[model samples]
Target: MQKNLLFYEKVNKRFILFLALVCFSGVLFAQNKTITGKVVTNESDSSLEGVTVKVKGSATSTMTGKDGSFSISAPANATLVISSVGFLSQEVAVKNQSNIIVKLATDQQSLQQVVVVGYGTVKRKDVTGAISSVTAAQIAKVPVTTLDQALQGRAAGVQVINNDAS
Candidate 1:
């Protein structure tokens, strides 16, 4: 019976040690960190509100405040993806840094691709007006000073008349 007790004591000691090691490892491997940053527009140098700041490869995310400031809890080595409408998306690496500043450029492709009508702007495919487009090549062929002269024969239902009869 004494030998059995000794064996049980050894097993209990090992179990206690294993539990302690697991707890210690949990403390060591904990990598959650608070990251703070500001997002701004590159062209205007103004704060970009409502920007989505997300930790890449994770579900952690937040939106910027009205002053373009944001704070998020993420892993130490995670990448942050910042995005907003009418601006380019940016990815910044945390790399143990506490504070960061992100500047997003304007997305010209998306901006110039939109068609502005009298009421609201619409995409190229969503335009429902009697719209006409003039290409640069067609403009280059015409050596006119004014747009009315350049578009004399280019668009349908458009009349170009000289006010001075010149």
Candidate 2:
């Protein structure tokens, strides 16, 4: 009957309108750009790995690679928030730049403070290699390429002799 045909036509028209609206909404939401950047230490300029890079006001986020590089998709004007343990968080506006460099300073307070909120038990007999532990502060005092070289004379009973003494 014509009534059934009219109802089917109305449904078809509504389906086409719904599809067009969905597509228009997608365009209005805007396309994001691929942004890339490197995060480094402000003082030493060394690249930092495992730093979290996130777009402000959005859940999009990524972590830097071993080379301290990151790629993320975000709106051109979005701001990037970079953070890492023991380092101060920083925010940089994208400003339509495809590539950017972010420098983060060491948060002295973060390094100095400890949570002091953990409890664990370890039997001495169950533990091994308790000779000595090396702290990062001590290692930083020495200037050497290899950690073994840096640790030379730093820890008791720890000796590192280069086999190739050329």
Candidate 3:
């Protein structure tokens, strides 16, 4: 009877150890894989720079280098989303593949809608600031000493205050 109890104890210990190994093996094998890819223009096949690459369902992301090459870690079956300015975004499946190449078509609407402003450029549809023009006639009508005073009423939201008490 004692021998049977000892055998059962050994069996229980071995069973627990086996279960632990199985759980750990599944986790180790399910880890994220490294994926590499390149982004290029559909028309020219020129490598694009500063393209954004991201894992579809997670925050993992990277940017393409000057050569349009990128590397990121994601699940083996995960999807990758690529995006850039003036180009349509794309998605690729990472299923048992380690390398990929994505061609992005130019968005004519986006290209035509960009407005070059004072310092930078932005989409025309996204411009929300009021652009009030001060005409030369308006500036001539204002008998002011400086240009700031001339824009007092001709321009919208213009405020000129003289800080001199004299």
Candidate 4:
């Protein structure tokens, strides 16, 4: 009878030890992972500087370096959201991957944020008078042989006809 009681106590002690080990292992494995990536433009394949890289559903975020490289710490199942001015945003899944490459396309919508009227700049909403704006980026898209040609079709109600003054 005494032997039976001793056996029962030993079994209970082993079970409790096993439960404690399982709990400790769970706590150890629940840790964050370090993720690294690079950001570039899809059109030009150039490094994008000062890009904002954020962990989705969390406040953890970091900015890219001058070489478009970034490093952050997050959970394995977390998602990363990358964004910058003049470029479209991108979201990538960690999925236990350590290194990633992200390409961002240019966003035309950001170009409409400001308007150049005459010699000064103004926000898009504050303009109440007739204003014609031309952005340097828009001019770069077209092949203009002269200054007159660059302004062609850029502003509303404005016409640029080459008079052959040369």
CA lDDT of every candidate: 0.88, 0.85, 0.86, 0.88
Off by over 4 Å in 1: 1-12, 116-166
Model 4 lDDT, full chain set = 0.88
Model 4 per-residue lDDT tens digits across residues 2-73: 999999999999999999999999778877888999999998889989999999999999999999999999
| Each prediction's number of clashing residue pairs | 0, 0, 0, 0
Tens-place lDDT per residue, model 2, 1-166, is 9999999999999999999999899888876999998999999999999999999999999999999999999998899999987788999999999999999998887455433211554433334333355679989988888876987887687677767776
Note the residue pairs that clash in candidate 4. Answer: none
Q: C-alpha displacement of 64 in model 3, angstroms?
A: 0.7
lDDT tens digits, residue span 64-89, model 1: 99999999998888999999877889
Q: Which residue pairs show backbone clashes in model 1? A: none
Better of 2 and 3 by TM-score: 3
C-alpha TM-scores of all predictions:
0.59, 0.54, 0.60, 0.56
> Model 2: runs farther than 4 Å from truth?
1-29, 114-166
Q: What is the lDDT, from 0 to 100, of the residue 27 in candidate 1?
A: 76
For candidate 3, lDDT tens digit of each residue in 1-166? 9999999999999999999999899889877889998999999999999999999989999999999999999998899999987789999998978999999998888666656566698775466665455667879987889876776777567676766767
